[model samples]
Target: MKYQIRHRTHYRYTQPLRSAVQTLCLTPRHTDTQHVHHWQLQSPTPLQPQTDAWGNHSHVLAVGAGARMLQCEATGMVETLGTPLQSDPLGPDPRLYLMPSALARADDALRRSALAAVRGVEGRQAQALALTALVAECVRYQPGRTNANTTAAEAWLGGVGVCQDQAHVLVAACRAVGLPARYVSGYFHARGGPELASHAWAQVCLDPAERRWLGLDVTHGCVVDERHVQIAVGPDYAACAPVRGVRSGGGGEQLTVSVEIIPQD
Candidate 1:
């Protein structure tokens, strides 16, 4: 499947930024399973986009005017090649170590929740899919409610989180249960779907016959379809991001983001 995306962002400042520095994570990344056919960003100032120390492509834009309007527009097409391997119980990949924080409590509420979802599932693939269903049934995929800083504990307890938060919790829970899991930031075009909103999910690697990374969207409670566009994969949230940056322009006083994702039928 091929998907075309159009994204627009507008920022209205309460006060003229004096001088502002803004970081953008709006760029859709291209990968083996994804391609960027066309892309653009329209801003009030020139964009000094560069690969950051972290190696993710970043957009660093500075506004000369104190108060100004910032707009970002981007369009691209990506294809899902279907993963080379999915749900491999025993692949050549190394074992994934879990973070202590992600598994701090052996009987934490969230761990219990994930276990309940896969009680009867013997293999990692089936268990991961079951957990995805649990998350989707447990929470709603609403944006603007949570952010990158939102804690996994809060999201799990609240039963509500944006895509990022949900992915974080799902991955953490998987790790907590001795499964190797990573976070994925990408775009998902549902079946006969519109260009998808900014989306994130998790991939778990369980040893046995299933060493392949299996994609699961707890936020949507479904396995990946053609709509999934993977940007990067990493052990945690900070890694595998499309874009990230620092603010040298006096913190910018304020910031806002607007994104419009449309899929070409």
Candidate 2:
């Protein structure tokens, strides 16, 4: 499947001041499952592409003073291939993902949740599917109830959150069950109703020997497919956020993000 993607992020400040420096993880990586044909990032500030420790392509954007509003847009064409039922993990040691992060920490309740998920599951793949289902069942999808910093345990306790929280919860639960899982940020084309084009999911290592990674979407209760365009992978959302930064003087910031993904003929 091929897709054309456009994403625009805009920010407004109450008080304008000097410079701002931001890290951008908006560029998609070419992998076994996906290939980037043409991609470009547009912003008022100059963008210098750099690869992070995790092999994600990042852009450092530096904006000089005097602009009250900043806009960043990314447009691209990508071809996504279906993962064969078997494949090797492409990056660093899988154990790196087993470690808990600030937002993906597992608690006693999360441990219990993990225990319940794999109670009768016979194989690792079955256990992973069960765990993903358990997370979806435990946390109802509700937006505006939590913020970006909300942890997996906190969202589980509330029983409501967005895709980001769902991915976090799934990551934490998988780790609790001795599975190495990491967070994935990407773009998804929604058919109808209400759905954010920008999406988040989890990839769990099912077979370290074969280096198999299984992509799971607890938010929509489905396995990630060609419809999903991979952007970045990390311990949690914070690491793969599309844009993050600090400014010398930008008071009371308001941000808006709009994303669209269309299939190509």
lDDT of each: 0.63, 0.87
TM-score of 2: 0.93
Worst 10 residues of 2 by lDDT: 82-91
Best by lDDT: 2
Which consecutive 10 residues in model 1 have the weakest lDDT in total? Answer: 88-97
For residues 1-265, could you state the per-residue lDDT of candidate 2 as single tens digits? 8988899999999988588999999999777788899999999967898988666899999888888988999999998886623243456787888899999999999989798879878987889899899899989999999999999999999999999999999999999988999899998775554545689999988887777788898887888777778899889999989999889887888989998888885
TM-score of each: 0.71, 0.93
lDDT by residue (tens digit), candidate 1, 141-195: 7767776767667777777878887787777777777777777777766565544
Superposed by TM-score, candidate 2 places the C-alpha of residue 36 at a distance from the truth, in angstroms, of 1.2
Instruction: Give candidate 1's whole-model lDDT.
Output: 0.63
Tell me, by TM-score, which candidate is best. Answer: 2
> What C-alpha root-mean-square deviation, in Å, does candidate 2 show against the real structure?
1.9
